[model samples]
Target: MYSQEETLRSTIDKSLKVIRLYDWLLNLYVLDFFVDNHWTKLPLSWQECFQNITPQDLGNILSEVPTKHVLPLSFISLIKAVKSLSLPRDKISNKNKIGLLLSEDICNGHPRLKNLFLKHVKLKKRHEICLMSKVVSGVAVESKCDAVVDFGSGLGHLVRVLAYNNNLYAAGIECQSQLTEEARSVQLVHAYRAALERILVDYDPKLKHAPVRNIKHSDTMTFQQYSTQALSRLNIPLPACFARGEADLRQWRRVVTLYTLRLALAPLVETVILLDRVLYILEHGLSCEIHPVFDPKLSPRNHIIVGKRL
Candidate 1:
């Protein structure tokens, strides 16, 4: 057992590595970053936010916006503020460091699931989860919750990790029909494959999922036999990663929104989206936390807000 102050000190130190950039904080308010040309992969939700912004609204915001000035947080200042804050001892204890490091038990468990699940998840998507896992696992453990709800869980990437890897009851709430359906399909395939392989191979049962050998399966003497048996028994459907069907590029663009391409080029909406998501979690009256997942220098999307039911 670690003292709360020890955990707080360590987490603050890790977050501080990039917290001084205070400039990154300021960028959150800059509107041009969202409209800038460098952003190429604007997410579906971002597209919605963009569409929601009226021309008149944008004009007024742009008119008053400075060429460059955004502000959010400072680690040192945070420490000073914490010292000055006169909150009750109970409340202070309740507010554990949001970014506690991942314990080996959760972070390193189910190595097979980590690798197998990533097969269908893209590289960039996997990278995001790697950063997310640190905070997610820490929050889940600290809050001691079995259920996790990912807000704006695009394509269910984080959901996949939580459910299959951590053996948690995780669900993603994505607004886009295409993205939600796609994630559901992918999860079904990944789960079926993992179930099949685990039963056939001798693995560490101490991990999250123990093998249920009695479940029906084909002989696994060879890959061909296993594959056939899996198909016949599981009848699993692969995700878009497995087969590329003819797609109307134009329609798909409209589905994801071509605005994504332009949005990525500028990436100004990122800070707004980040702050909005964090606030959205806090407002729900759950035990919520805000923590930096990785070094911001590596990926500005390193911070996250995790909420656990009280």
Candidate 2:
């Protein structure tokens, strides 16, 4: 008979195996990094978080992990446990940093689900982003919009995807200086790589007919070029202008983590202003559409609001 601890350990081992297999297929480097740097270092609390996950939940996670699903289920249990303890804000200070770093790396590595970081909650599968983006784009087209604004643009993943793939004029509003700087840096790096690749493909005759490599390189190159142009045209000025006289916005509930709260507040404020602005545009007989993206998992509060003006 397996002891309770042994049972939990076995379950975790199996689940991790599945996760590793999935990561191997989609982005092995992420798996290597997680295993090498953080897997063993996970705190007891974190381990318990995974340990407590229901078998059914574990199975669901296993099924989706291989497909590169972006759902928050993997860590949702832990985040909830941490929130329940009413830990000091500083205790969980690194949570946002870890999440942001992980999501950013995942975005850079996975071409299929690059915008996973922008989502407030984790998604169950990669197709969810496609589904959500399609819905939002449809709403925008129906509204006949000229530009889209993505609030709380984590690593600017959604902005990059929409702008690069759809050729839409989009802007991402982020409050964290570190994240903003990183986003800008990623865009620059991707652009330079893309420019180099284009030069290579155009001049390297021996490698011109390598379809598989060429296609992969071309896709990345195209995405990078699109990202660079979109980022440049966005004109995202630093330290987004906030409402006057609200410097000590600390009055806002310090729930979850400061990073989480800050990310949350930016969109909430942006949504109110955006909705009103869109309403006014509609009232003025302007052709435009407003589409909002929301994440159901990261607390019922996760939301992404976009207003498109035709």
Candidate 3:
């Protein structure tokens, strides 16, 4: 078994390598994809690699192992390198994989109290709270934490489950008044349809139509049209770049490709953030371990840094 110091140091080293190698992708602003001329920033080889790529082609690149996808040799190599450098995200052990907790778990299985706390919670948030609460419960039990303090607790979801279901002393701090009051609240679809729609409408005046107030009928219209209408309702104007033809088909595709590349590095980026916390705790002579307590698909930011004072 590796010592805590050894594990953290090694993980930090790999994370830094990925960060340094793809600093450009990490730094690029997704919101400024059109304005920044981001395609010019990509390596010429990488630009050539993804220039003629299709939607399905980019999907294959995003997978864990691209067995059937045909990509340039360099792109394949980059993917492999990234995969090799990323920390393993699987559950640490069966010991850490505790069952999820709910109101029923703490409310003595009372049916009335079962889902009251979960009233406004979505499936993803429900899954996360159940899993993470159990993990935090375990860590608190192990360390005998005086009281668990949750930062950015927004609506106190996790802490609620932790304190009630797990019977641990917990407190939550939230800075956002909106979230404090009610702690609330993807996809590459058809070549950035919404972005394309905004640009196309400006590019061709004939497509323009009055904005609709309700987007509930989004299914009836193209995403671009729906988004344009929605934005119009809010009196938000499409960027001038779209009207100028600055962000055209080629730029859209490049932006998607660049975004996908950045997605590939997301795990490494998260690791760097989580491990930096671990390293800081270690510096202070506290024990720290990152637990992959939540499902990655359900909760992309699944790693939890648990610290214990030595």
Candidate 4:
């Protein structure tokens, strides 16, 4: 395992190189896909490379979120370029050194509080809160922290878990008043439900179980449908190239290929950001570590930046 300094230096070097190498791809706005004829920017060889790729193949690029993909022999050099520049997003185990310190087994949340607080949370969010609450609580306990302050505390899910489940004093700071109000509203529901449980012995079946199914775009969704849903969510209008009925299939394949390439670069970007934070802590003579506490496929931003002044 490399030391933190070694890891940080290596990551920064690679990140800079990657950003410089793909500066054009990185800077081009998705909104300008058709307006600027982004497809025309690709070299003819690159365009021809993606010509025969099918929509299902394009969907596979997204659905798998590939740690590794089987590339054609012809594209071996392309794979080499990406692999050499991209930081590996390998599943981190306790045996591996992500930071100087090792992570412990996450303590389970309080069962009663879990029932009260987890109703509105989605599956991915539930997974995150369940794991992250324990990690944050463990850090607070280790540092003998008087209170936990959560920044960007959307709906206060983690804060609630830390405060109620872990028996820690926790407060959430949210820049949006709507979310703050909603969190208060949710807190009341928890209080009311807890009161009901004591007085009426109420049982909520929904709280006990949640059903989940893995859906793949390649299996169930058409490429157009997938692209439409993605852009609609982001409030981006369909690019004119795609909006036309005779949209080139080659352009669609290129869009998927380029998007997957960007996704592959994400870990390098995250490493740069998290390490910068770690360096700031180290510079101040404080202890800091980044723990990969969540499943990366489920929570892409899985690394938790942990620091303590003591």
- For candidate 3, the per-residue lDDT at 1 reads 100
Which residue pairs come into collision in candidate 2? Answer: 70-123, 71-122, 71-123, 72-122, 144-310, 145-309, 145-310, 146-309
Stretches of model 3 off by over 4 angstroms after superposition:
1-3, 65-70, 96-106, 180-247
lDDT of 2 by residue, 114-169 (tens): 44444543443323343345555666677776578878775666666566655578
Choose 2 or 4, whichever is better by lDDT. Answer: 4
**C-alpha TM-score for every candidate:** 0.33, 0.25, 0.73, 0.64
* Candidate with best TM-score: 3
Instruction: State the lDDT of candidate 3 residue by residue for 142-195, as single tens digits.
Output: 877647898899888788777666777789988878653642213322234435
Give the runs in model 2 whose Cα sits over 4 Å from its true position. Answer: 1-132, 180-299, 302-310
Predicted candidate 4 versus true structure: per-residue lDDT over 220-300, tens digit per residue = 554446445433433334344243423433355555565555565555566677777787787788878777776676777
Please give the range of 10 consecutive residues that has the lowest summed lDDT in model 4.
188-197
Judged by TM-score relative to the true structure, which candidate is superior, 1 or 3? 3
Candidates ranked, most accurate by lDDT first? 3, 4, 1, 2
| CA error at residue 40 for candidate 4, angstroms | 3.2
Which regions in candidate 4 have their CA more than 4 angstroms from the true location?
A: 1-3, 55-114, 180-251
- Model 2 has an lDDT value of 0.39
By TM-score, the candidates rank as 3, 4, 1, 2
